[model samples]
Target: MQKLSPVPYGSLIFAPMEGITDEAFRKTILKLYPEWDYLATDFLRVPSAGKYPLKHLVTHFGKELSDVGWVKDKTMFQILTSHRSFTVEMVKDVAQLGYPWMDINLGCPSNTVTKNGGGSSLLLDLNTLRSLIKNIRENFPGRLTAKIRTGFHDTSGFKDSIRLLNDEGIEMITVHGRTRDMMYKVPAEWNYIEEAVKISQVPIVGNGDIWCSADVDRMLKETGCHAVMVARGALKFPWMAQTYKRGFREETSHERLQKIKEFFQEYRTQLESESISLRGLLKQSKSVSRYMLDGVENGEAIRRKLLLSQTPPDFFDILKSL
Candidate 1:
């Protein structure tokens, strides 16, 4: 139950990415590098129309949730939903499950998610978004947050949406500076995010395309944001958080890869010691190995070999050859 240090502007955080940012991965990143200050879990889906009991939101209990008991204070439970009634119910469910804070996701751009009146699509209907925040504030007992994009198609529509959430007393806001339509195809618009900061009452956290400490510095300088959330950039380089803290000095290609390999070896041993099944463990390795090959020649070939292998030995053989 220890709290993380003061984050007026907060600090670098690992954004929740499904299939990639699980308990095991978080632990690996934290263990190897203790510089990351916050982490949002991959969102839990909420059923609509009150068809499902709220207990579904507590599904993390005793499973992945337990993995966070040691560091629960630094964690934020992310939920995907745009319904006021559903969000309120889900908030109650999360609090009852012992979660201290919850974050609402409104930035996901997946076609399926948007089609359901959830995710970024909510920006198109500010009333529902307002109602969702107002009701959660009125009923939910714990901290509430919203993670939003600039807008779905045009960012101009989100100004009022962000203002209303701030007015509703939401604790914090995370803005990825792109319209949902842009997806991850373009660089995040730091200027648009700066505009949100000007209008918002609550603390605003800026997200998108921050790859290193210099990117972090640029984000703060360009947008005057309180903090940043790293997604793909963190996945491509696990040491990014540490790199930010130490100041951005370019690491030689060879030095970078060597450090990554040593860390991967530590991660491998931890998986083995836990008695995790080889296949399940290997699945994670394949994803992590890409980052491990930063400077190696034809690293794709190395990744392909690891992808085909079923055992740790098979994957290690490919890594050793590199």
Candidate 2:
């Protein structure tokens, strides 16, 4: 029942990573590091044919929709859809569910999403993007936000995209400074983010390649964005946001390893309680381990063992030895 800024000044947000930032993962992260200013659900894709039923929306959002505690206020619901026909009605349903914050996904670059005329592909067609935003704004009375890449293939349309979002009353935009074509092959172009902040009427949140507490400060100082959103960086260092806000303290290698071990143990427990089968849990653990063990000592070898792990106990045992 209370409205909040989607991207408050100096806020730190945990980016919505598909398949990674699910309900269980969010709960685990919040339990360990509750300092994040906002948390976002991985985007819920709206079918082009018809409006999503209220029951289906509730199921997709999981328990966060029903939560009335502080977590509800800190969490935001995100949706992805290229079709404008059913968008307004679906958003109206979302409003009735009592979410005060919502975000449209305009940055996803996966072939499946783009080929369907959704995600970054929408950047190529401002007309459709404009119609979608205009309709959703008229129907949804909440903080309407968007996440975007600079452009589909180049930076030519980047400024225009920002202006269009501003004109449509987008309250905040998270700029992930890479064109859809560039993907993750090169470094993020923060200069474009700087340009966005300079020209936009709404607050901009800078996201890309932020891997540590220092990077968080550097992004804020460099881009002058209202906030910073951490994606893969959070997967690598789950405590990064808490460390940034509380002050980064030096940790010994042993201490870091212990913390990593404990974090995964908690994640494993959460997955088990959610009724995930051993095979499913193993798959998820390995997926996260790819990020978690990237820079740890002997991480490559540990990851190899982790990937080869056949059971949950074996997986955790390998992690514990690290």
Candidate 3:
């Protein structure tokens, strides 16, 4: 199998989860730990010319976001579209913004996005896909990458589709193990991702079913992809990125619990600094904090109470009492 530089190929990555990986969350992770190799913004849905205002582009990556020190050069902006013209215009605008890298989302499975000829729908039209990618390359300034699934429904036409992308000079490719039709339901078909690794020329990143640092190692050992990106895993356990960076060696349950406590304390400090009200602060961590119980005792019960937590102090008291 081919090998990349010593840089951890399994560098934990935060998927461009719309509404979930926003500035508030990104800041929380960055401040708490610097485990992620790069951060890809949630897909910026661009319908047509004049539809996506510059401010819209700027808001997601605009002043406030751009100022986040952790995201500056490390962040990749991902845009979704069906029209090559629209894609080119958006690329051009982002180029003007001085971004060093950008990604095109061809893996989104949202029904509304697909019906509009965007996201994975472009997969059905190879010619349109090639045209749009070509426009992006010709217009955008820095690194260009594409994030895709194994295929739309069947893997039959996947090779030709991937070839078109490889031939177009994309800098990298990140493939989610499932197709558009599969959504996030079934286990990721690592074998199919193995097939893609053999065919694609650019560096490949495997993403799917990676729930922990060990999972990251196993995915790389099995797929031969250059890197692995973690979405739900990172969300489930914020320290996942940090854990991988520190290596996947086993830890005692008590040690692991200690790490969890540190994560919560650090995260709480960040929330407080955001000037969010105490109640609001705890509410924000509710969804993701539940993930910390992965290796803990009575984790499900803890997650249940935390999910239903009404206030910051209430959640803190529960955590303390536990």
TM-scores of the models, in the given order?
0.87, 0.95, 0.86
Q: Candidates' lDDT values, in order?
A: 0.75, 0.86, 0.77
Show how many residue pairs clash in every candidate, following the order shown: 1, 0, 1
Runs with alpha carbons beyond 4 Å of true place in candidate 1:
1-6, 49-70, 269-277, 290-297, 308-310
RMSD of each: 3.1, 1.6, 4.0
Question: TM-score: which candidate is best?
Answer: 2
Clashing pairs in 1: 7-10
1-322 in candidate 1: lDDT tens per residue? 2323335574888888876666667667778877888777788777775635544544442245444664566677888886633666666767666676678888889998888888889898988888877776776666678899999999778788888888887878899988999998898888887988898877788998887668888888888888888887787678888888887885776667576676778778766665779787888788766555644566667667778898878887766655
What would you estimate as the lDDT of candidate 1?
0.75
Q: For model 2, where is the 10-residue window of minimal lDDT?
A: 60-69
Error of 3 at 97 (Å): 1.3
In lDDT terms, how accurate is model 3?
Answer: 0.77
Q: Is candidate 1 or candidate 2 better by TM-score?
A: 2
Ranking the candidates on lDDT from highest down gives 2, 3, 1
